[model samples]
Target: MGSLRFISSPFSATIQDLGREALAYYAIPASGALDKKSLQLANKILGNPLHAPCIEFSFTPGKIEFESATTICLTGADMQFKVNDKIIKLNSIVGIKSGDILSGSWPKLNARCYLAVKAKLDLPNIYASYSSYPNAKIGYNSGANLKKGDQIHWKEIPLNVSLENIKVDDKPFCESIKIKKAPEYHLYSKDITDQLIANEFSIDSNSNRMGARLLEKIIGDKFPELKASVPVLPGFIQLTPSGTLIVILQDGHTTGGYPRIAYIPENELSAFNQNAPRKKFKFKLV
Candidate 1:
Protein backbone atom coordinates (compact mmCIF):
# COMPACT_ATOMS: atom_id res chain seq x y z
CA MET A 1 0.00 0.00 0.00
CA GLY A 2 1.22 3.50 -0.88
CA SER A 3 0.15 7.11 -0.63
CA LEU A 4 0.35 9.54 -3.55
CA ARG A 5 1.10 13.06 -2.45
CA PHE A 6 0.94 16.29 -4.36
CA ILE A 7 3.76 18.72 -3.71
CA SER A 8 2.88 21.46 -6.17
CA SER A 9 0.45 22.25 -8.97
CA PRO A 10 -0.69 25.44 -10.67
CA PHE A 11 -4.18 24.42 -11.67
CA SER A 12 -7.05 22.56 -10.08
CA ALA A 13 -6.76 18.80 -10.68
CA THR A 14 -9.35 16.17 -9.83
CA ILE A 15 -9.97 12.44 -9.78
CA GLN A 16 -12.41 11.38 -12.52
CA ASP A 17 -13.61 8.10 -13.92
CA LEU A 18 -15.95 7.42 -16.88
CA GLY A 19 -18.72 9.31 -14.96
CA ARG A 20 -22.04 8.51 -13.36
CA GLU A 21 -24.69 7.46 -15.84
CA ALA A 22 -28.51 7.44 -15.53
CA LEU A 23 -28.55 9.93 -12.68
CA ALA A 24 -29.34 13.10 -14.55
CA TYR A 25 -32.96 12.64 -13.56
CA TYR A 26 -31.91 13.78 -10.12
CA ALA A 27 -30.24 16.85 -11.65
CA ILE A 28 -26.78 15.29 -11.39
CA PRO A 29 -24.17 16.05 -14.00
CA ALA A 30 -22.23 13.30 -15.71
CA SER A 31 -18.90 14.97 -15.08
CA GLY A 32 -15.83 12.99 -15.98
CA ALA A 33 -12.66 13.26 -18.07
CA LEU A 34 -12.92 15.61 -21.00
CA ASP A 35 -10.53 13.36 -22.93
CA LYS A 36 -12.08 9.97 -22.44
CA LYS A 37 -10.00 8.34 -25.13
CA SER A 38 -6.74 9.43 -23.56
CA LEU A 39 -7.93 8.30 -20.13
CA GLN A 40 -8.76 4.93 -21.61
CA LEU A 41 -5.35 4.63 -23.24
CA ALA A 42 -3.55 5.39 -19.99
CA ASN A 43 -5.53 2.78 -18.08
CA LYS A 44 -5.02 0.29 -20.87
CA ILE A 45 -1.26 0.78 -20.70
CA LEU A 46 -1.27 -0.30 -17.06
CA GLY A 47 -3.91 -3.01 -17.64
CA ASN A 48 -6.48 -1.20 -15.50
CA PRO A 49 -10.16 -1.16 -16.31
CA LEU A 50 -11.26 1.29 -19.01
CA HIS A 51 -13.23 3.21 -16.43
CA ALA A 52 -10.85 3.52 -13.49
CA PRO A 53 -10.06 6.34 -11.09
CA CYS A 54 -7.47 8.58 -12.74
CA ILE A 55 -6.05 12.01 -12.09
CA GLU A 56 -7.02 14.75 -14.54
CA PHE A 57 -5.07 17.99 -14.49
CA SER A 58 -5.63 21.44 -15.82
CA PHE A 59 -2.75 23.96 -16.40
CA THR A 60 0.30 22.54 -14.65
CA PRO A 61 3.48 22.88 -12.76
CA GLY A 62 2.32 19.47 -11.66
CA LYS A 63 4.48 17.58 -9.18
CA ILE A 64 3.71 14.36 -7.34
CA GLU A 65 5.46 11.78 -5.17
CA PHE A 66 4.59 8.22 -4.30
CA GLU A 67 5.51 6.32 -1.14
CA SER A 68 5.35 2.82 -2.62
CA ALA A 69 5.86 0.83 -5.85
CA THR A 70 3.29 1.44 -8.55
CA THR A 71 2.99 1.52 -12.31
CA ILE A 72 1.43 4.55 -14.03
CA CYS A 73 0.67 5.94 -17.45
CA LEU A 74 0.25 9.45 -18.85
CA THR A 75 -1.85 10.59 -21.78
CA GLY A 76 -3.77 13.54 -23.25
CA ALA A 77 -2.05 16.98 -23.08
CA ASP A 78 1.63 16.58 -23.81
CA MET A 79 2.95 18.60 -20.90
CA GLN A 80 6.74 18.51 -20.61
CA PHE A 81 7.36 16.03 -17.77
CA LYS A 82 10.27 14.08 -16.34
CA VAL A 83 10.35 11.15 -13.98
CA ASN A 84 13.50 11.01 -11.86
CA ASP A 85 15.34 13.32 -14.32
CA LYS A 86 14.41 11.21 -17.33
CA ILE A 87 11.96 12.64 -19.86
CA ILE A 88 9.06 10.28 -20.36
CA LYS A 89 6.81 9.90 -23.37
CA LEU A 90 3.08 10.48 -23.40
CA ASN A 91 0.84 7.42 -23.92
CA SER A 92 3.48 5.26 -22.24
CA ILE A 93 3.69 3.40 -18.97
CA VAL A 94 6.35 4.14 -16.31
CA GLY A 95 7.21 2.38 -13.07
CA ILE A 96 7.87 4.26 -9.86
CA LYS A 97 8.90 3.54 -6.27
CA SER A 98 8.78 5.13 -2.84
CA GLY A 99 9.84 8.79 -2.75
CA ASP A 100 10.15 8.99 -6.52
CA ILE A 101 9.37 12.54 -7.67
CA LEU A 102 7.50 13.19 -10.91
CA SER A 103 7.08 16.72 -12.15
CA GLY A 104 5.92 18.56 -15.23
CA SER A 105 5.07 21.97 -16.72
CA TRP A 106 2.16 22.87 -18.92
CA PRO A 107 3.32 23.84 -22.37
CA LYS A 108 1.87 26.60 -24.53
CA LEU A 109 0.09 24.17 -26.81
CA ASN A 110 -2.05 21.87 -24.66
CA ALA A 111 -4.79 22.21 -22.06
CA ARG A 112 -5.38 18.95 -20.17
CA CYS A 113 -3.78 15.57 -19.35
CA TYR A 114 -4.53 12.27 -17.70
CA LEU A 115 -2.37 10.17 -15.33
CA ALA A 116 -3.73 6.72 -14.58
CA VAL A 117 -2.21 4.40 -12.02
CA LYS A 118 -2.50 0.60 -11.88
CA ALA A 119 -4.60 0.81 -8.71
CA LYS A 120 -7.67 2.97 -8.09
CA LEU A 121 -7.69 5.98 -5.79
CA ASP A 122 -9.43 5.41 -2.50
CA LEU A 123 -12.11 8.09 -3.00
CA PRO A 124 -15.69 8.25 -1.75
CA ASN A 125 -18.10 7.71 -4.61
CA ILE A 126 -21.34 9.65 -5.06
CA TYR A 127 -24.13 8.68 -7.42
CA ALA A 128 -22.12 5.66 -8.50
CA SER A 129 -19.18 7.80 -9.56
CA TYR A 130 -15.70 8.55 -8.30
CA SER A 131 -15.59 11.83 -10.27
CA SER A 132 -15.35 15.24 -8.66
CA TYR A 133 -18.42 17.31 -9.49
CA PRO A 134 -17.59 20.83 -8.36
CA ASN A 135 -21.15 22.07 -8.59
CA ALA A 136 -22.54 19.32 -6.38
CA LYS A 137 -19.44 18.52 -4.34
CA ILE A 138 -20.32 14.85 -4.83
CA GLY A 139 -16.82 13.48 -4.50
CA TYR A 140 -15.37 13.69 -1.01
CA ASN A 141 -12.14 15.43 -2.09
CA SER A 142 -14.07 18.72 -2.52
CA GLY A 143 -13.78 19.45 -6.21
CA ALA A 144 -10.89 16.96 -6.02
CA ASN A 145 -8.17 19.53 -6.67
CA LEU A 146 -4.93 18.36 -5.08
CA LYS A 147 -3.08 20.89 -2.96
CA LYS A 148 0.31 21.13 -1.31
CA GLY A 149 0.85 18.21 1.14
CA ASP A 150 -2.37 16.45 0.16
CA GLN A 151 -2.16 12.65 0.22
CA ILE A 152 -3.98 10.24 -2.12
CA HIS A 153 -4.05 6.59 -1.17
CA TRP A 154 -4.62 3.85 -3.69
CA LYS A 155 -6.41 0.54 -3.21
CA GLU A 156 -4.22 -2.56 -3.08
CA ILE A 157 -3.71 -4.62 -6.21
CA PRO A 158 -1.62 -7.68 -7.01
CA LEU A 159 2.07 -6.85 -7.25
CA ASN A 160 2.66 -8.99 -10.33
CA VAL A 161 0.66 -6.82 -12.78
CA SER A 162 2.68 -6.10 -15.91
CA LEU A 163 2.98 -2.89 -17.91
CA GLU A 164 2.92 -2.48 -21.68
CA ASN A 165 3.44 0.14 -24.34
CA ILE A 166 0.44 1.43 -26.25
CA LYS A 167 0.40 2.96 -29.71
CA VAL A 168 -1.95 5.93 -30.16
CA ASP A 169 -2.92 7.75 -33.31
CA ASP A 170 -0.64 10.75 -33.73
CA LYS A 171 -3.61 13.14 -33.77
CA PRO A 172 -6.84 11.27 -33.88
CA PHE A 173 -8.78 14.45 -33.14
CA CYS A 174 -6.88 16.90 -35.34
CA GLU A 175 -9.72 17.54 -37.73
CA SER A 176 -12.64 19.83 -36.94
CA ILE A 177 -15.21 18.25 -34.63
CA LYS A 178 -18.19 16.84 -36.46
CA ILE A 179 -21.64 18.21 -35.63
CA LYS A 180 -25.25 17.41 -36.35
CA LYS A 181 -27.80 20.18 -36.74
CA ALA A 182 -30.10 20.50 -33.76
CA PRO A 183 -33.87 21.00 -33.70
CA GLU A 184 -33.56 24.78 -33.77
CA TYR A 185 -30.75 24.91 -36.31
CA HIS A 186 -33.14 26.32 -38.83
CA LEU A 187 -34.05 29.29 -36.63
CA TYR A 188 -30.92 31.21 -37.48
CA SER A 189 -30.74 32.88 -40.88
CA LYS A 190 -28.64 31.55 -43.77
CA ASP A 191 -25.87 34.08 -43.06
CA ILE A 192 -25.72 32.92 -39.47
CA THR A 193 -25.52 29.28 -40.46
CA ASP A 194 -22.79 30.04 -43.01
CA GLN A 195 -20.76 31.89 -40.44
CA LEU A 196 -21.34 29.16 -37.92
CA ILE A 197 -19.86 26.44 -40.11
CA ALA A 198 -17.06 28.39 -41.80
CA ASN A 199 -15.80 30.73 -39.12
CA GLU A 200 -13.22 29.85 -36.49
CA PHE A 201 -13.81 30.75 -32.86
CA SER A 202 -11.56 30.91 -29.84
CA ILE A 203 -12.42 29.42 -26.47
CA ASP A 204 -12.96 32.15 -23.90
CA SER A 205 -11.91 32.46 -20.26
CA ASN A 206 -15.50 31.77 -19.23
CA SER A 207 -15.02 28.13 -20.11
CA ASN A 208 -15.12 25.39 -17.48
CA ARG A 209 -16.25 21.77 -17.33
CA MET A 210 -19.86 22.92 -17.61
CA GLY A 211 -19.35 24.45 -21.08
CA ALA A 212 -17.15 26.63 -23.26
CA ARG A 213 -18.08 30.11 -24.40
CA LEU A 214 -16.56 31.02 -27.75
CA LEU A 215 -14.98 34.39 -28.50
CA GLU A 216 -16.70 34.97 -31.84
CA LYS A 217 -20.32 36.02 -31.67
CA ILE A 218 -22.96 35.46 -34.31
CA ILE A 219 -23.47 38.66 -36.28
CA GLY A 220 -26.59 38.00 -38.29
CA ASP A 221 -30.23 38.50 -37.41
CA LYS A 222 -31.22 37.58 -33.86
CA PHE A 223 -32.70 34.16 -33.37
CA PRO A 224 -36.39 33.99 -32.47
CA GLU A 225 -37.56 32.55 -29.18
CA LEU A 226 -37.06 28.76 -28.95
CA LYS A 227 -40.38 28.19 -27.17
CA ALA A 228 -39.13 26.04 -24.27
CA SER A 229 -36.21 24.28 -22.65
CA VAL A 230 -34.93 20.94 -23.86
CA PRO A 231 -32.54 18.17 -22.97
CA VAL A 232 -28.93 18.91 -23.83
CA LEU A 233 -25.95 16.61 -23.97
CA PRO A 234 -22.29 17.33 -23.33
CA GLY A 235 -21.57 18.57 -26.83
CA PHE A 236 -24.66 20.74 -27.22
CA ILE A 237 -23.98 24.10 -28.89
CA GLN A 238 -26.35 26.92 -28.11
CA LEU A 239 -26.44 30.48 -29.36
CA THR A 240 -27.33 32.92 -26.63
CA PRO A 241 -29.66 35.89 -27.00
CA SER A 242 -26.69 38.21 -27.30
CA GLY A 243 -25.20 35.97 -30.00
CA THR A 244 -22.66 34.20 -27.76
CA LEU A 245 -22.20 30.59 -28.82
CA ILE A 246 -21.41 28.12 -26.08
CA VAL A 247 -20.09 24.63 -26.49
CA ILE A 248 -21.06 22.24 -23.72
CA LEU A 249 -18.53 19.94 -22.03
CA GLN A 250 -18.56 16.94 -19.67
CA ASP A 251 -19.86 18.88 -16.67
CA GLY A 252 -22.51 20.67 -18.71
CA HIS A 253 -26.04 21.25 -17.49
CA THR A 254 -28.48 18.53 -18.46
CA THR A 255 -31.01 20.97 -19.91
CA GLY A 256 -30.46 24.34 -21.51
CA GLY A 257 -32.56 27.44 -21.74
CA TYR A 258 -31.14 28.54 -25.06
CA PRO A 259 -31.95 26.95 -28.38
CA ARG A 260 -29.82 23.95 -29.24
CA ILE A 261 -27.91 24.39 -32.46
CA ALA A 262 -25.39 21.58 -32.95
CA TYR A 263 -23.97 18.54 -31.19
CA ILE A 264 -20.57 16.87 -31.35
CA PRO A 265 -20.76 13.20 -32.18
CA GLU A 266 -20.72 10.82 -29.22
CA ASN A 267 -17.65 8.97 -30.46
CA GLU A 268 -15.68 12.23 -30.70
CA LEU A 269 -16.93 13.99 -27.56
CA SER A 270 -13.70 13.44 -25.59
CA ALA A 271 -11.52 14.61 -28.44
CA PHE A 272 -13.00 18.11 -28.32
CA ASN A 273 -11.61 18.86 -24.85
CA GLN A 274 -8.24 19.51 -26.49
CA ASN A 275 -9.72 22.79 -27.74
CA ALA A 276 -8.84 24.62 -24.59
CA PRO A 277 -9.06 28.28 -23.68
CA ARG A 278 -7.80 30.64 -26.40
CA LYS A 279 -7.60 27.67 -28.80
CA LYS A 280 -9.31 28.16 -32.16
CA PHE A 281 -11.66 25.69 -33.80
CA LYS A 282 -13.71 25.47 -36.98
CA PHE A 283 -16.87 23.49 -37.50
CA LYS A 284 -18.64 21.47 -40.18
CA LEU A 285 -22.34 20.58 -40.09
CA VAL A 286 -22.96 16.98 -41.07
Candidate 2:
Protein backbone atom coordinates (compact mmCIF):
# COMPACT_ATOMS: atom_id res chain seq x y z
CA MET A 1 0.00 0.00 0.00
CA GLY A 2 1.25 3.49 -0.87
CA SER A 3 0.74 6.48 1.41
CA LEU A 4 -0.25 10.06 0.62
CA ARG A 5 2.34 12.10 2.46
CA PHE A 6 1.13 15.53 3.47
CA ILE A 7 3.83 17.92 2.36
CA SER A 8 1.71 20.68 3.77
CA SER A 9 -1.77 20.73 5.31
CA PRO A 10 -3.50 24.08 5.64
CA PHE A 11 -4.67 25.25 9.02
CA SER A 12 -8.01 23.76 10.10
CA ALA A 13 -7.63 20.90 7.61
CA THR A 14 -8.14 17.31 8.73
CA ILE A 15 -8.14 13.91 7.07
CA GLN A 16 -11.36 12.12 8.04
CA ASP A 17 -13.42 9.08 7.19
CA LEU A 18 -17.08 8.39 7.96
CA GLY A 19 -17.53 8.83 11.70
CA ARG A 20 -18.22 6.20 14.32
CA GLU A 21 -21.97 5.75 14.72
CA ALA A 22 -21.68 3.88 18.04
CA LEU A 23 -19.92 6.81 19.71
CA ALA A 24 -23.09 8.87 19.36
CA TYR A 25 -24.44 7.09 22.44
CA TYR A 26 -21.78 8.82 24.52
CA ALA A 27 -22.92 12.22 23.16
CA ILE A 28 -19.95 12.48 20.81
CA PRO A 29 -21.35 14.24 17.79
CA ALA A 30 -20.58 12.36 14.57
CA SER A 31 -17.67 14.62 13.67
CA GLY A 32 -16.67 14.05 10.08
CA ALA A 33 -17.03 15.85 6.80
CA LEU A 34 -19.78 18.50 6.91
CA ASP A 35 -20.85 17.89 3.32
CA LYS A 36 -21.17 14.13 3.56
CA LYS A 37 -23.34 13.61 0.49
CA SER A 38 -20.73 15.31 -1.63
CA LEU A 39 -17.98 13.26 -0.07
CA GLN A 40 -19.77 9.98 -0.73
CA LEU A 41 -20.52 10.89 -4.31
CA ALA A 42 -16.89 11.83 -4.94
CA ASN A 43 -15.80 8.44 -3.67
CA LYS A 44 -18.41 6.67 -5.76
CA ILE A 45 -17.14 8.44 -8.88
CA LEU A 46 -13.72 6.87 -8.35
CA GLY A 47 -15.11 3.39 -7.51
CA ASN A 48 -14.20 3.75 -3.85
CA PRO A 49 -16.59 2.75 -1.13
CA LEU A 50 -18.87 5.55 -0.03
CA HIS A 51 -17.23 5.89 3.38
CA ALA A 52 -13.60 5.77 2.33
CA PRO A 53 -11.18 8.18 4.00
CA CYS A 54 -10.88 11.69 2.58
CA ILE A 55 -9.46 15.09 3.41
CA GLU A 56 -11.89 17.64 4.90
CA PHE A 57 -10.78 21.24 4.53
CA SER A 58 -12.29 24.06 6.55
CA PHE A 59 -12.26 27.67 5.31
CA THR A 60 -8.61 27.50 4.10
CA PRO A 61 -6.98 26.00 1.04
CA GLY A 62 -4.51 23.05 1.09
CA LYS A 63 -1.55 21.82 -0.88
CA ILE A 64 -0.14 18.31 -1.34
CA GLU A 65 2.24 16.26 -3.48
CA PHE A 66 1.38 12.75 -4.61
CA GLU A 67 4.04 10.07 -4.25
CA SER A 68 2.30 7.56 -6.51
CA ALA A 69 -0.26 7.43 -9.31
CA THR A 70 -3.80 7.78 -8.02
CA THR A 71 -7.33 8.91 -8.82
CA ILE A 72 -8.80 11.78 -6.82
CA CYS A 73 -11.98 13.77 -6.49
CA LEU A 74 -12.97 17.13 -4.99
CA THR A 75 -16.46 18.18 -3.92
CA GLY A 76 -18.42 20.67 -1.84
CA ALA A 77 -16.92 24.19 -2.13
CA ASP A 78 -15.97 25.51 -5.52
CA MET A 79 -12.60 26.51 -4.12
CA GLN A 80 -10.11 27.18 -6.84
CA PHE A 81 -8.29 23.84 -7.21
CA LYS A 82 -5.28 23.12 -9.38
CA VAL A 83 -3.05 20.15 -10.18
CA ASN A 84 0.43 21.24 -11.28
CA ASP A 85 -1.04 24.73 -11.81
CA LYS A 86 -3.89 23.52 -14.05
CA ILE A 87 -7.35 24.45 -12.75
CA ILE A 88 -9.79 21.59 -12.20
CA LYS A 89 -13.55 21.53 -11.84
CA LEU A 90 -15.36 20.71 -8.65
CA ASN A 91 -17.65 17.64 -8.23
CA SER A 92 -15.62 15.65 -10.73
CA ILE A 93 -12.91 12.99 -10.49
CA VAL A 94 -9.37 13.38 -11.83
CA GLY A 95 -6.26 11.27 -12.16
CA ILE A 96 -2.81 12.30 -10.97
CA LYS A 97 0.60 10.73 -11.17
CA SER A 98 3.46 10.69 -8.71
CA GLY A 99 5.26 14.01 -8.08
CA ASP A 100 2.20 16.03 -9.12
CA ILE A 101 1.43 19.07 -7.02
CA LEU A 102 -2.18 19.63 -5.94
CA SER A 103 -3.29 22.94 -4.50
CA GLY A 104 -6.60 24.63 -3.62
CA SER A 105 -7.74 28.20 -2.94
CA TRP A 106 -9.98 29.63 -0.26
CA PRO A 107 -13.59 28.93 -1.18
CA LYS A 108 -15.48 31.41 -3.28
CA LEU A 109 -18.96 30.07 -2.52
CA ASN A 110 -18.96 27.44 0.24
CA ALA A 111 -16.85 26.91 3.35
CA ARG A 112 -15.89 23.22 3.43
CA CYS A 113 -14.62 20.82 0.77
CA TYR A 114 -13.80 17.07 0.54
CA LEU A 115 -10.80 15.53 -1.21
CA ALA A 116 -10.86 11.75 -1.73
CA VAL A 117 -8.01 9.75 -3.12
CA LYS A 118 -8.72 6.52 -5.03
CA ALA A 119 -7.81 4.42 -2.01
CA LYS A 120 -8.56 4.76 1.69
CA LEU A 121 -6.10 6.32 4.13
CA ASP A 122 -4.54 4.59 7.10
CA LEU A 123 -4.96 6.29 10.49
CA PRO A 124 -5.58 5.38 14.10
CA ASN A 125 -9.16 4.26 14.67
CA ILE A 126 -11.31 4.84 17.68
CA TYR A 127 -14.47 2.76 17.93
CA ALA A 128 -13.94 1.68 14.32
CA SER A 129 -13.57 5.14 12.78
CA TYR A 130 -10.76 7.30 11.49
CA SER A 131 -12.80 10.46 12.01
CA SER A 132 -11.30 13.11 14.26
CA TYR A 133 -13.06 14.61 17.26
CA PRO A 134 -10.65 17.36 18.30
CA ASN A 135 -12.37 18.19 21.55
CA ALA A 136 -12.18 14.59 22.79
CA LYS A 137 -8.81 13.88 21.17
CA ILE A 138 -10.11 10.69 19.60
CA GLY A 139 -8.99 9.19 16.28
CA TYR A 140 -6.32 10.39 13.83
CA ASN A 141 -3.26 12.61 14.39
CA SER A 142 -3.91 13.54 18.01
CA GLY A 143 -7.56 14.07 17.05
CA ALA A 144 -6.76 17.56 15.85
CA ASN A 145 -6.92 19.34 12.52
CA LEU A 146 -4.28 18.47 9.89
CA LYS A 147 -1.03 20.45 9.81
CA LYS A 148 2.06 20.72 7.64
CA GLY A 149 4.42 17.73 7.06
CA ASP A 150 2.05 15.04 8.33
CA GLN A 151 2.25 11.59 6.67
CA ILE A 152 -0.94 9.72 5.64
CA HIS A 153 -1.33 6.19 4.28
CA TRP A 154 -3.74 4.88 1.64
CA LYS A 155 -4.73 1.43 0.43
CA GLU A 156 -3.36 0.36 -2.92
CA ILE A 157 -5.60 0.73 -5.96
CA PRO A 158 -6.81 -2.54 -7.37
CA LEU A 159 -5.47 -3.41 -10.80
CA ASN A 160 -8.94 -4.15 -12.17
CA VAL A 161 -9.88 -0.49 -11.93
CA SER A 162 -12.95 0.39 -13.89
CA LEU A 163 -13.81 3.95 -14.85
CA GLU A 164 -17.30 5.35 -14.66
CA ASN A 165 -18.61 8.91 -14.36
CA ILE A 166 -21.33 9.51 -11.82
CA LYS A 167 -23.55 12.53 -12.28
CA VAL A 168 -24.76 14.35 -9.18
CA ASP A 169 -27.88 16.48 -9.17
CA ASP A 170 -27.77 19.95 -7.63
CA LYS A 171 -30.98 19.31 -5.71
CA PRO A 172 -29.28 18.25 -2.48
CA PHE A 173 -27.34 21.49 -2.18
CA CYS A 174 -30.19 23.84 -3.18
CA GLU A 175 -33.24 22.21 -1.59
CA SER A 176 -34.73 23.71 1.57
CA ILE A 177 -34.29 21.72 4.74
CA LYS A 178 -37.42 20.53 6.51
CA ILE A 179 -38.18 20.57 10.23
CA LYS A 180 -40.63 18.97 12.62
CA LYS A 181 -42.14 20.74 15.56
CA ALA A 182 -40.25 19.75 18.68
CA PRO A 183 -41.84 19.24 22.11
CA GLU A 184 -41.07 22.85 22.94
CA TYR A 185 -42.56 24.19 19.74
CA HIS A 186 -45.86 24.97 21.40
CA LEU A 187 -44.18 27.34 23.82
CA TYR A 188 -43.97 29.99 21.13
CA SER A 189 -46.97 31.69 19.59
CA LYS A 190 -48.40 30.60 16.27
CA ASP A 191 -47.16 33.80 14.66
CA ILE A 192 -43.65 33.12 15.84
CA THR A 193 -43.76 29.61 14.45
CA ASP A 194 -45.06 31.00 11.20
CA GLN A 195 -42.19 33.46 11.07
CA LEU A 196 -39.72 30.65 11.57
CA ILE A 197 -41.05 28.83 8.58
CA ALA A 198 -41.67 31.82 6.33
CA ASN A 199 -38.71 34.11 6.96
CA GLU A 200 -35.34 33.63 5.30
CA PHE A 201 -32.52 33.50 7.81
CA SER A 202 -28.82 34.19 7.31
CA ILE A 203 -26.09 32.08 8.85
CA ASP A 204 -24.42 34.03 11.64
CA SER A 205 -20.69 34.71 11.41
CA ASN A 206 -20.11 33.14 14.80
CA SER A 207 -20.62 29.64 13.43
CA ASN A 208 -18.63 26.40 13.51
CA ARG A 209 -19.07 22.64 13.64
CA MET A 210 -20.44 22.97 17.16
CA GLY A 211 -23.52 24.94 15.97
CA ALA A 212 -24.76 27.88 13.96
CA ARG A 213 -26.51 31.00 15.17
CA LEU A 214 -29.13 32.25 12.78
CA LEU A 215 -29.88 35.87 11.93
CA GLU A 216 -33.56 35.17 12.01
CA LYS A 217 -36.46 37.57 11.93
CA ILE A 218 -37.33 39.06 15.29
CA ILE A 219 -40.34 37.16 16.55
CA GLY A 220 -41.74 38.78 19.67
CA ASP A 221 -42.17 36.09 22.24
CA LYS A 222 -44.05 36.16 25.53
CA PHE A 223 -41.31 34.32 27.41
CA PRO A 224 -38.25 36.41 26.71
CA GLU A 225 -36.53 35.20 29.85
CA LEU A 226 -36.80 31.48 29.12
CA LYS A 227 -33.59 29.58 29.71
CA ALA A 228 -33.73 25.88 30.37
CA SER A 229 -30.92 23.49 29.49
CA VAL A 230 -32.13 20.42 27.61
CA PRO A 231 -30.93 17.60 25.40
CA VAL A 232 -30.22 18.57 21.80
CA LEU A 233 -29.53 16.85 18.49
CA PRO A 234 -27.88 17.86 15.22
CA GLY A 235 -30.91 19.69 13.86
CA PHE A 236 -32.35 21.17 17.02
CA ILE A 237 -33.66 24.72 16.80
CA GLN A 238 -32.76 26.42 20.07
CA LEU A 239 -33.99 29.82 21.15
CA THR A 240 -31.81 31.97 23.40
CA PRO A 241 -33.22 34.16 26.15
CA SER A 242 -32.82 37.26 24.02
CA GLY A 243 -35.02 35.79 21.27
CA THR A 244 -32.10 34.82 19.04
CA LEU A 245 -32.49 31.48 17.28
CA ILE A 246 -29.75 28.89 16.79
CA VAL A 247 -29.73 25.80 14.67
CA ILE A 248 -27.54 23.13 16.19
CA LEU A 249 -25.28 21.32 13.76
CA GLN A 250 -23.18 18.12 13.49
CA ASP A 251 -20.60 18.99 16.12
CA GLY A 252 -23.20 20.55 18.44
CA HIS A 253 -23.26 19.49 22.04
CA THR A 254 -25.39 16.53 23.01
CA THR A 255 -27.31 18.73 25.43
CA GLY A 256 -28.09 22.42 25.50
CA GLY A 257 -29.55 24.95 27.90
CA TYR A 258 -31.68 26.90 25.45
CA PRO A 259 -35.31 26.18 24.65
CA ARG A 260 -35.35 24.04 21.57
CA ILE A 261 -38.17 25.45 19.52
CA ALA A 262 -38.12 22.98 16.64
CA TYR A 263 -35.94 20.28 15.10
CA ILE A 264 -34.77 20.47 11.55
CA PRO A 265 -35.82 17.39 9.61
CA GLU A 266 -33.15 14.71 9.91
CA ASN A 267 -32.61 14.50 6.17
CA GLU A 268 -31.76 18.17 5.91
CA LEU A 269 -29.26 18.35 8.76
CA SER A 270 -26.42 17.89 6.31
CA ALA A 271 -27.63 20.89 4.32
CA PHE A 272 -27.29 23.14 7.33
CA ASN A 273 -23.87 21.77 8.22
CA GLN A 274 -22.16 23.06 5.09
CA ASN A 275 -23.81 26.47 4.78
CA ALA A 276 -21.29 29.32 5.17
CA PRO A 277 -22.02 32.42 7.18
CA ARG A 278 -24.15 35.03 5.38
CA LYS A 279 -25.75 32.35 3.19
CA LYS A 280 -29.54 32.57 3.23
CA PHE A 281 -31.52 29.52 4.31
CA LYS A 282 -35.24 28.89 4.71
CA PHE A 283 -37.05 26.05 6.40
CA LYS A 284 -40.20 24.01 5.82
CA LEU A 285 -42.12 21.99 8.37
CA VAL A 286 -42.83 18.39 7.58
Give candidate 2 misplaced runs (Cα > 4 Å): 5-11, 159-165, 221-228
User: Native-vs-model 2 lDDT?
Assistant: 0.75
Candidate 1's TM-score: 0.93
- Per-residue lDDT for 238 in model 2? 85
Q: For candidate 2, lDDT tens digit of each residue in 1-286?
A: 7656666767477756666685566888877667778778778777788887688887765678888888788887777889988999877768788888888777755677888887767778877777787888876777777877776777777633443546675444443668899878887888888888888887887776778888764568464344555678778888776778888776678877778789977666657666667778788888
Model 2 Cα shift for residue 13 (angstroms): 2.4
In model 2, residue pairs whose N, Cα or C atoms come closer than 3 Å (at least 3 residues apart or on different chains), thus clashing, are: 229-257
lDDT of 1 by residue, 1-286 (tens): 6678887764868888899999877778789888888888888777788899788887684789888888888888877878879898887768787888889886566677888887867888887888888887777467756677878888766545444445676463444777899878987788888988889877897788899888999886657666778888888899998899988788888888998878888777776777667777788788
RMSD of each: 1.9, 2.4
